[model samples]
Target: MLILVTNDDGVRSPGLRALALSLGEIGRVVVVAPDRNRSAIGHALTLDHPLRAEEIKPDVFAVDGTPTDCVNLGIHGLLSQRPDLVVSGINCGLNVGDDISYSGTVCAALEATLMGLPAFAISLDTSLFSHADLSVSTRFAKKLAVDIMEKGLPEETFLNINVPFGPCSGVELTTQGKRNYGESVVVKEDPRGRKYYWIGGTENGFEDLPGSDCNAVHRGYISVTPLRTNMTNDKTYAVMQQRSFACMGDID
Candidate 1:
């Protein structure tokens, strides 16, 4: 089996290396990842500028683009054969709650799902600057990859896996949780007296939503949330169908 491995963390990331090495024991692994950290980039495609990929080592390619671009290039341009699975991360930090919408790690898996491939993004619920050993997360990722390949993901659906630091209590299937985001922008003055702004915010915590990824991770369990590429709200669609907008006929 050919497995395509990629991450939002740069190609040299310890998490990425650990993931690729662990999964290599199961199948042929090809790594195509961003040359630099592109965290929280979402599902952005580099259409405005040309992308460049360099094979820094055998079976490893570093692309000067987002995690989504790496997946695209891996499946279409780099590998000779289609991969059986696409696994993003073993990311340094967690991608739970509303953060998945802004996560390049999760978006990489989403891109693969859009291309009709089985995929999952795995993250470690730890600080990005921490040098925690990734053996546990990598092992679980390998196991999960095998399971995904054997069982097959639901149609148009991928997964978001967040493994807590240290020993895990167990694994739990969860839903996307909600985050309580406060003012995230930080204003500052540069040495030149010009104002500059930073985007990230202090962690404000999550909603008390049980059976959610955030909750599961907080309880020392690996959180596995099945995510779908289809963004349509079925309940809203059903409600809109019953409401007749006869006023629309008055448009000039």
Candidate 2:
């Protein structure tokens, strides 16, 4: 079996290394990741500028692009053969709730799903320098990879896995949760007295929704949320179908 491993935390990330090493025990692992951290970049493709990939070492390539770009290049460009699975992360932090929409880690898996591949993004719910033992997450990743290869993911669906910081109780299949976003922009003055703004928000917690990814992680359980590439709201589509728009020949 061949596995493509990538992450938004860049090529040198310990989490990335740990993930690659752990999965290597199961199959041939090729790592194609961003040269620098590209967290929260979402599913952005570098079409405006040319992308560059450097083979830093055997089976490892670093691209000067987003996580999605790495997945694209890994599957279509770098590898000798198509990978059986694409696993993004063992990320530096958690990607849960509404934040998954803005997560490069999750989006990497999304990109693979778009290309008709089985994929999953796994994240550790901890700070970058927390020195958390990643054995649990890596072990689960390998197990999940085996399960995926055996059972196969549903058509057009991928998973987002978030492992808690410390001891893990078990695993929970969850839905995307809601976040309490607040006061995101921070205003500041530069050395020249010119105002500058920072775009990060203080962590404002999440909605107390049961059976949610955030809730599962909060209880020290690994959260696995299945995501689909199609964003169409079936209920909304049904509602809109009831409201008929008979087009008059011409608008005055």
Against the hidden reference, what TM-scores do the models get?
0.97, 0.96
User: Tens-digit lDDT track for model 2 on 1-252?
Assistant: 999999999999999999999999999999999999999899999999989999999999999999999999998888878899999998988899988989999999999999999999999988863579999999999999999999999999999999999898999999999988788788999999999988864665899999999999999999999999999999999999988677754567
Which window of 10 residues has the lowest lDDT sum in candidate 2? 243-252
- Steric clashes per prediction: 0, 0
Off by over 4 Å in 2: 247-252
lDDT of 1 by residue, 47-145 (tens): 999899999999999999999999999999999999999999988889999999999999999999999999999999777636586877988999999
- lDDT of all predictions: 0.93, 0.93
Candidate 1 segments exceeding 4 Å error: none
Candidate 2: clashing residue pairs, number? 0
